[model samples]
Every structure is written in C-alpha cells, then in structure tokens.
Target: MIRTKSFLSLLLLTALLSLQLTTRAEDGYRLWQRYDQLPSKNHLKQYRQSLGEVMVQGSSPTLTVVKEELQTALGGLLGQPVTITENSRKKEILVAGTPASSALIKGLNLEADLQKVGKEGYVLVSKKAGGKKYTVIAANTDLGVLYGSFHLLRLLQTQQDISNLQVSNSPKVQHRILNHWDNLDRTVERGYAGFSLWDWHKLPQYIDQRYLDYARANASIGINGTVLTNVNANSLVLTPDYLRKVKALADTFRPYGIRVYLTARFSSPIEIGKLKTADPLNPEVIAWWKNKVDEIYRYIPDFGGFLVKANSEGQPGPQNYNRSHADGANLLAQALAPKGGIVMWRAFVYDNNVPEDRAKQAYTEFKPLDGTFKQNVMVQVKNGAIDFQPREPFHPLFGAMPKTPLMMEFQITQEYLGQGTNLAYLAPMFKETLAADTYANGKGSTVAKVIDGSLHNYSLTGMAGVSNIGNDRNWTSHPFGQANWYAFGRLAWDHSLTSEEIAEEWIKMTFSHDPGFVAQVKNMMMGSRETVVNYMTPLGLHHIMGWDHHYGPGPWIKDKPRADWTSVYYHRATEKGIGFDRTKTGSNALAQYAPDIQAQWGNPATCPEEFLLWFHHLPWDYKTKSGRTLWNELCYRYSGGVDSVRAMQKTWNTQQGKVDKERFKQVQMLLTMQEQDAKMWRDACLLYFQTFSKRPIPQELEKPANTLEYYMSLDPKFVPGI
Candidate 1:
C-alpha cells in the first residue's frame, strides 16, 4: 500500500512539472506569431474594447481558417474567450471578408480601395455605418481577408493602437515563394536544423499538425508558393505514388492560400520514362513531360510549377545535346504554360572548366538568352555572382535580363554564414543586395525595381528564398534564424521596408515589446551580418571556407578537383599581394556590368573598399582609404568582427530576465559559442594571410593562440550541413 501510494504521487508530480515547463518555455515553435498576452493590462483593455466581438464574414476554407486563427490568437492575447456575438446589429464588431460574402462589407463601397490593393491585397479601416462604428477588413478575395487578419493580429501582437486603423497593403512581387532544398530520403541538403519536414512514407495517410502550422505561418507573411523538393531533384517524386502524397500536402495548404511546387529533375524522361535521351528537342521527351504534368494537375489542380537546376554542378541538362539553357528551361515551360503554371529556371550555372572568372560565367550564359525564354519562364538569379557569400557585388544578370522576368533568389539558410549555430540576422545582407544600383536603364535602376517588374515591365514577377526550415521544434535551429525567415517573407512582400524596421518589428512580436529590449535587440540584429562578414570575409574576401563543409577558415585550401572550388582561385593571395583581379588587366569580369559601374569599380582607387579586393589585386602595402596598409586594414576588420560579437554578447546578457528564461539562456549560450567562433575565424584567417603579407599583427589586436601549422592541422569531423 505504501509503495503504490508513492508511485501515484510521483506520477502526479511529473505531470504537473511537465505542464509548467511547457507553459513557461518559449521554444520558438510559434515563430514571430507568438501571441501570448499583452504586456500592459491597460493596453489589453484598449484592445479588447476595439475588438469587442470578432466576425470573419465568410464560410470558405480560407475564411474558416481566418476565423480559427483569430479565435485562438485573440483568446490568448485578451485572457478570455473570443465572443463573435449573437446580436445582429452589434457596434464596433471587427469584421473581415470580401465584398461578395458580406452585404455590410459590400455596402461600404470599397471598390476603389479594393482595386488599388489588387486581388491578394486588403483594406483595413475603422468606419461609421448606420450610427455604429465598425473596424472592417475588406478585400476582393478571401485570401486577402486572411492576410488582413494576420496584419491586424500583428498590430495587436506588437501592441499598436488599432482603434483608428486605416491600412492598405499588397505584396510588391507576385509568386512570393520558398524553395526547400529537401530531398526524398528525408535529408535536407545544407539543412543545419534537422531532418526534412515532409515525412514521405507517412505523408499521404497522416497529416502532421506541423504542415498546417507551416502553412499558417507562411500565409501570415504573404508567402503563397513553396517548391517542395531540392533543385538537385530525384525522378521518383514524379512517380504516381509520390504524386498522391504531394496532393495531400497541396490539399492541406490550399486552405491557407499556399500552393505547392516541385523541383523537376531534368533527366526525368531518361530516368522515369525509360527514354533514350533527355534532350529538350526530343519529341518523346516533350510528350512525356506534358503527360507527367497533366497527371500532376489531376492530383493537384493548383500546382504552382517547376524549379529547374540544369547544366550546373553535374546536373544533366539540354547542353548534353548542345542546346542552350533556354532550350532546357523551355522544355518544362512549354508543358506548364498551358496549365497557367510557370517555370523558375535557375541562373546559378557556371562552366567552371572555362578559363574565365566564375563570377562572370552566369552573366555570359544568360545575358544573350534574355528575350529567348518563354513568357511563363522566370529566370531565378542569386543575389550575388558567386554562391551565397557573406557579401558580394549584385549579379550582373539582374538588370541585364530586362525582357525576361528575373526572380530574386535569396538564401535564408545560413550555409555560407555560419549555418545553424551562429546568430547572424540576414536582413541587412538581403537589403544590401536589393538596394544595389544596377544602372541598367539609368541611375535609378536598383535591383529591387528590376525584380518587382517596375524597371523592365515584365509581366510575371517573383522572389524565392532558400528556406532554412527543418523538423526541429523551433523550425529553424537558432531562435534568431526565425527572424531571417521572417525578414525574407517581409522583404519579398515589400522591398521598401528597411532592414532596421523589419528587425524592430520581429523583435517586438517574437521576444518582447519593452522599448529597451526591442531597441537593443534590433540594434544587435541590424549589425550582425556586418559583424560576421568583418570576422569571416571582410573587404572582398570570398569562398575561403573549409573544403566540403565550409565550417571554418581554410585560406590554405587548394588543389581541389576544380580550380574555382579552391580558395586560391578567388583570393590569389600571392607573396606580393592578396585579392582577385577582375579588371580589364585581369579577367575583365567588370565588362559584364554597366559602363558607369565598370568605370567606377574597374579602377582600384575608385572602388568601394568593401569590394576593393573583389575587383582588384592589390599589394600588401597598398594604402587603403583609411590610410592603413591593405594588410593592417584586413587585420583590423578581422579583430573588429570579434569585438562586435562580444558587444552583442554583452547586449544579450543584459536581457536575461526581460524574456523567457529558456530562450534567454539559449541565446546566451549561442552568443558564447559565436564569440568563440569569431575568435577562431579571426585567428585562422589573419594568421594564414599573414604568411603571405609577412606583416606583424597590429599592436592592439590579440595574437593568434596557435601557429598557422596548428590551425591547418586541425580538421573538424562531423560538421553539420555538409
């Protein structure tokens, strides 16, 4: 009797502790939509009064979700159950819907407003009608109403005054999407967080709640499309069995206005259809693709389309038969066009075998084929000429491909920027690329204008982010990585939003609305990308990371299979100088850009110091704009990066009690790791580069803890995201 009584007590105690831990822990699964409660009771009272009764005025799948989301969010935020009300003529009722669904919304005459914001946009206003004031969320479509609901919730979450709300908004770009690099085997390529989110074997039968939550989070941020597979795709996904599974996901996400896309393997005809050649010009190949697409549409009526990676990185392409990238892309485009689907053909191709600079290859291949692509095809270009580096000049393809709709492909994954462990907020990096002056048509031709279809007047426009999401409980491994994902969606919707503004908004919604916490965290996030660059690859240094894993500094890396894959090809850090020469005297990569830019950047003296070593090979003793020798500036930048990280640690440590203990401690520990890593990057790169520069470390900077030989000898195994 005593033993049984003791067991029962222990069980009861365990359950209570579990409940408390769950309730108290902020694991970041909710992402930026963490709507726990208003910080101030007076603020909560005002919100409750403004949102007296909630009414999403429709019965469609999308509006139903809108209702449920509002109910849950409002209930948690207000500390009471949301009341929709039984009264027919209630005043101050928060209503949301399209004009066709509600007579009250129709009577408000929102035609002009609705037309201005477009089909996917909404008008949120507070109006007086029939001696009653009502806060209305009106749009022309149910999806728009859903978007408005999220925006209103954001206002509430951030504790803004919504009593006199008048907001009109729309996504700047069409087809705002996420490109997951997840493969069929449940392993994500360059996925630092965990396994793939899609459980292929169990997917069609059992729908994970994570799928629903994922769609909800994306819908809240106006991301409408998701390419489900890796760009280096497998043909098995095109099989009938997998199509059924994809259909299940499509059905689940349809309610939240998120369409599903898949990456089409170029050799599907050869692999899946048993054809001899996967040539784009082959009739059998063409017919096979058409039939496969037809079958996919039967399963998923609203399939977005395909993202293709061909003729790059050993991927099969039409080039096997001497056809251009356009031919390979058009093969898929022809099949998708009739169904109102589009092809996002990637422009990340490079024939590294060519005796030319890698940065110039993509432009040479795609520039001449600008007007040749099918109208339904969008040429997806990376932000930088090289891979997702810490910083690089904007791709020459952006403004150059005016006749074709160029889609911006930004990496939200931190593959090149410390992966999952480091706290590197990427909004500043994204904004830097977006704000680059392309000088395509004139001085005002920014990359943002070219992408949103304002520069060249292309009919179709899109922006794709390489998703950092994984099956981790936090979605993204690092808690702050969620901020990068949030920033990508926010900027994809509106490029005009400043990075600082996005950081502030994310901080307020995700962590705390307290002025000091938000301000301090925002400041830290705003400078994080620069700090990482300063430490890792400052002043035009590029692609010097460790071989295969790219985890640590590998400035001595050479003799890789391809010359471009080696650090030696980019930096060219000889005994006399350090930096690549891409000027007229060297590879002439500058010729790909506009004449104005070429004239400015081609000359080493005129180039911005940030890109000084990128375009010009300078001697170690060359005087920088700051009057320091090139070697000293490089040393200072590396040390400054380490110092900035320590400052961020100090900033984060002061907020221990301001947020949840779980997330606070999580960030604190991660910051410590970051500080240590920053030191490693500084020491390794400076020590190795010093061997060539033959310069002493500055008096103020800390000396490296180990010799260059010791640093070179150390090779970390089991690096994630290889």
Candidate 2:
C-alpha cells in the first residue's frame, strides 16, 4: 500500500515539475506580446487603478477580440484580472468601440476626431462622463477600435504613462502587408528560417494556434494584408483545393482586419485554364482569367489582390507575347477591378539578352509604361534597383513614375545580410532608402513621400515586406530577427518614426525596460546594418556573394548562366582599377536619375564615399575621402567590417545576465559565428581583389588565415533555402 502511494506521488511530482519548466522557459514564442508583470510597484498600482473596469461596446468578432485582448494584457501587466462590465460603476473605466456601436461614444461629440482619422484610424482619449473618469477608444469602424486597443496595451506594456492619453493613430500607407515567399511544398524561397508555416494539406480542416497568433501580431502593428504564396507562383494555388485552405486563413485573419492576397502566375491560363496561350490581348485568355478571379472571390470575398512577377528571372509574362508589362498587369487588373481587388506588378525585371546595366533595366522598362497601368495596379519596386544587396541606392522608379502608384518592397529575410546567422537590424537600411532625396519634384521630394502618395498624389499606396517568419519556435530563426519584422510593420505604418524610436519600443516590449539595457541594445541595433555593409559589401561594392546560394565571398565568381549573374561583371576588377564605371564612359546609368542626383553621384570626387565604386571605377593609386589610396581603403573597409563584428561580440557579452539565458546564449553563439564569417569575408575578398590590385595587405591588419586557393576550394554543400 505504501509503495503504491509513493509511486503515485512520484508521478504527480514529475507532472508539476514539467508544468513549472514550461511556464518559465523564454523560448521567444510570445514575441513582442510578452505582457509580463510590471517591474515598478507604483506604476502597476497606478495602472490597476486607471484600468479597474473595462466596458467595451458592440458585439462583433473584432470587438470581442479587443475586449479579450484588453482583459488578458491588463490582467497580465497589472497582476490582477480586470472586471468586464456593460455599465461601469467605478470611477475609471476603459470604454472602446466605434461611435455607431456605442451610444455613449456617439454622444461624446467625436465626429470631428473621427473625420481626422479615416476608416482604419482610431482616437483614444481620457474623458469625464457622469462624474466618472473614462478612457475611451473611439473610431468610425470596428477595425479602428481593435487597433486602438492594441495601442493602449502597448502603452501599458512599455510602462508609459497613460493618464494624458489623447492620441489619434492611423496607418500612413493604405495597405501594409507581409509577403510570405512560402511555397505550396512548405519551402520558403530565400528564407533562412525553417520550413513554411502554412500546412496546406491540413490547413482548411485543422487551424493551428500559430495562425491566430500570426494574425494577432500583424494586426497589433497595423498590418492589414498578407500575401500567403511566393511571387514565383504555382498555378495550383489558384485551384479550389488551395482556395479552400486560403479561405480558412482569411476567416482566421478577418477578426484582426487582415486580408489575404496571392501571387498570380501569369502563365496560369496555359497551365491551369486549358488554354493554348497566355496572351494578355487574347479574348480567350482574358475570359479565362476573369472566370478564375471570380472563382477566387467566391471563396475569399475580401481578397486584397494579385502580386505578379513576370518576365523576370524566367517567370513568364506578356513580354513573351510581345506585349508591354502594362498589358500583363491590366489583364489581371481588369478581372480583379470589379471585385475591388488590386494588382501589385513587380518592377524587378532584368533581360540578360539586352546586356544593359542590370540596375538601369528596371527603370527603363517601367518608366515608359508609367501612366498606362490601370487604376487598381500598383508597381511594387524594391528599395534598391538591384536585388536586395547589403546596400544600394534607392530605386529611381519611385518618383519617376508619377502617374502610377509605387509600392515599396523590403526583404525582412536576411538573404544577403548574412542569412540567419548575423544580427542585422534592417530599420537603418530601410530608413536610408526612405530618407533618400529622390528630387523627383525638386529638393524636398523624398522616396518616403513618393511612396506615401504625397509626392505624386496617387490615391493608392502600399508597402510590402518579404516575410522572414517560418515554423521555427521563434517565428524568425534568429531571435533578433523578430525586431526586423517588428520594425518593418512599424515603419510601414508610419515612416516618420525614427529607427532609434522603433528600436527602443521593441527592446522595452521584448526585453527589459531597464534604461541601461535599452540604451546599449538600441546602439547595437542602430549600428548593425552599417556594420554588415562595411563587412559584406562596403564602399559601393555589391552582389559579390557566393554563386547560387549567396552564402560567402565569391568575388572570383565568373562564367555563370548569365554574364550579369557573375561577380566579375559587377566589380569589373582589373590590374589598373576595381569598380564598375556607370558614368558617361561606361553604362551611363547615372543619367537615369534626376540631374541633381546625377550631379551628386555622377562625379566620383563629389560623390559620397559609400557609393564611390558603384558609380565610378578607380585605380589602385586613386585617393578616397578617408585620405587612403583605393587599395588601402578597400583593405580598411573589409578589415573594419570584421572588427565591427568583434565589437558586436564584446557588446553582446556584456549583456549576458541582462537578457534571458536561452536567447543570450543563442545570440552569443551566433555572434561568434558572425565574427568567423566576417573574417572569411575580409580575407577572401581582400585576397581576390589583391590579385587585381597587385598590392600588399596592410601590415597593421591581420593576415589571411588560409591561402587564396584554400578559400576558393572550400565549398559549402546543401546550404538551406536553395
């Protein structure tokens, strides 16, 4: 009898211990929604007093979510369950809803405030009603109330004072979206994270909790749309099988005000419609597309629209049919226009057959067809002219296409920024492109203004981020990668917010609010992008990564499928000089930009040192802004990149006890690998370029660990995301 009792006790003890371990583990699954107990007793007391009772008005899916979120967040942060009531007897009560839904809110005379912020915008204010202090979150629609609820929760999570909370908020961009480059096979393209999140085979029947959480996270940051498929689209996704799965996701996301979009394979007509050709002008093809689009709307009524990648990187488009890109886009637009859906046509086209400057080709192709696109069509342009390099000038197409709506496309995945290993905060890089003076409408015309519809006054504007999220326990493989996702959504909502402001907000909500820790981490994040550029592709150097996988240094890469795909074609290194001459002497790509931009970047002497090599090819003996010869400058920049990695390692080491044990160790190990990778980049690039410069390595810098032949011989196999 005693043995039986003891055995039962042992089992119970083990169960209890397992539960305890699960509760304490900081595996980063919560992301920025970590509503931990407030550290300050006084602050907690004040918050509890102000949010003692919640009276959310209306009965809708979104309003219910808002109430539940407030209850959960407030309960977690204040260390007490908040009372939810229809009528508040307490002095301070939280009231939230659209004016139509709440009689009290409508009587509050907030029409002027509602007018200021449109359909998706919200107003949060502290008011006195019937001698009772009430915190009211009001908007014209339920979606806005949901957004305001998140804003209120964010304020409390970040330990900000909410007493004088009179704030009106709305997304600057009409459509803020995350483009998941996830394939039907569950593989993500250029994705460093694990396999895709959508389990297509099981999605319609079985909805994972992660899907709901993903919607919640996106909605919290004001993201209203998500493209669930890859741009290199498969026609199968448009079929009924995939549409059912998509409907399930859309149903899940609808409560969060997020609509789902899919990439439209231009050749779907031939591939799936049983048609012979996908000619945009062909009547049969046009009819087939209209029928297909109508079928999609039947399943997903609130579908955002289509994102098309045509005649670029082997994707089929109207170009194959001798038609313009506008023809291809308008064909799809015509079908979706009646359904209130839009078309996001990608401007990443490059024709290796033409042999023009790869950077200039996008501008050449899209600039001429600017005013020709349909009203629902938005040309999605990458931040830079080239593929997502470590650094590049803003795409000249931003301001040049005045009659068309241009959407900004940013890669949140670290494909070129050291993939999943290095911690590269991308907000600084994004801010750099946004802040660049496009000069499309004289001096004050910025890229941000062009895309925000202020510069061109286009009614439709949007921003799309290539999502880095995946099946990893932490959505992004790297823990710090969460910040990039967070940063992108925040910036997409409001480009006016500084990188430092965003970084600080992320740090406080994700980690500790300790001023010392926040300051140190913010500095690290702010400088991380520049550190990556310095180490990977400094001083106008671009697209020199390894062949195919783009993992490591491959300055010697040559003889690829296309001449432009080769590293030698971009760098153009010779015994006399290193760097591509894009001036009047060579490709004359400089003339594509505004004359003011041309004047600034056209002359190597007057150009910013960061883009020196990008615009002009210089000799080894040429002098730079740093007062060093071209060879020495190259060596310094490469070495400096390695040194910066070392500094990051040291900075992270000091934060050992400041962050959680799981994340701290993970980041620490990743930083060590980053240091090693930085060294390889420095050595491999310097050694290869030295062969052309015919110069000796700087004596002060560390010597190469391995020979040029050894570095060249080392090849990584089965690299992920191939």
- Report RMSD for candidate 2: 3.8
- Score each candidate by Cα lDDT: 0.91, 0.91
Q: lDDT tens string, model 1, 1-722? A: 99999999999999989667544767889998876777688889887876768866668899888888888898888877887642346666888888898888898888988999998999999988888888888998999999999999988888788888889999999999999999999888889889999999997999999999999999988899999999999999999999999999999999999999999989999998999999999999999999999999999999999999999999998888999999998989999988999999999988767888999989999999989999999999999999999999999998998899999999999998989989999988989999999999999899999999999998999999999999999999999999999999999999999998888889988888889999899999988999999999999999999999888788889998899899988999988998999999999999999999999999888999899999999999999999999999999999999999999999999997788888999899999989888888999999999889889999988888888898888799988666
Off by over 4 Å in 1: 1-23, 85-87
What is the Cα-based TM-score of model 1?
0.96
Model 2, range 1-722, lDDT digits (tens) per residue?
99999999999999989666434548898999998788888889888888978998788999988988888888889888888777777888888888889988998888999999999999999998788888889999999999999888888888888887789988889999999999999999988889999999897999999999999999999999999999999999999999999999999999999999999999999998889999999999999999999999999999999999999999999999999999999999999999999999999999899878999999999999989999999999999998999999889898899999999999999999999888999999999999999899899899999889999999899999999999999989888999999999999999999999999999999988888889988999898999889888889999999999999899999988898899999999999998889999989998899999999898888999888889899999999888999999989998988898888888889986677788888888999999989999999999999999999998998999998998899799977777
Q: What is the TM-score of each candidate against the true structure?
A: 0.96, 0.97
Candidate 2 worst ten-residue window by lDDT: 18-27
| lDDT winner | 2
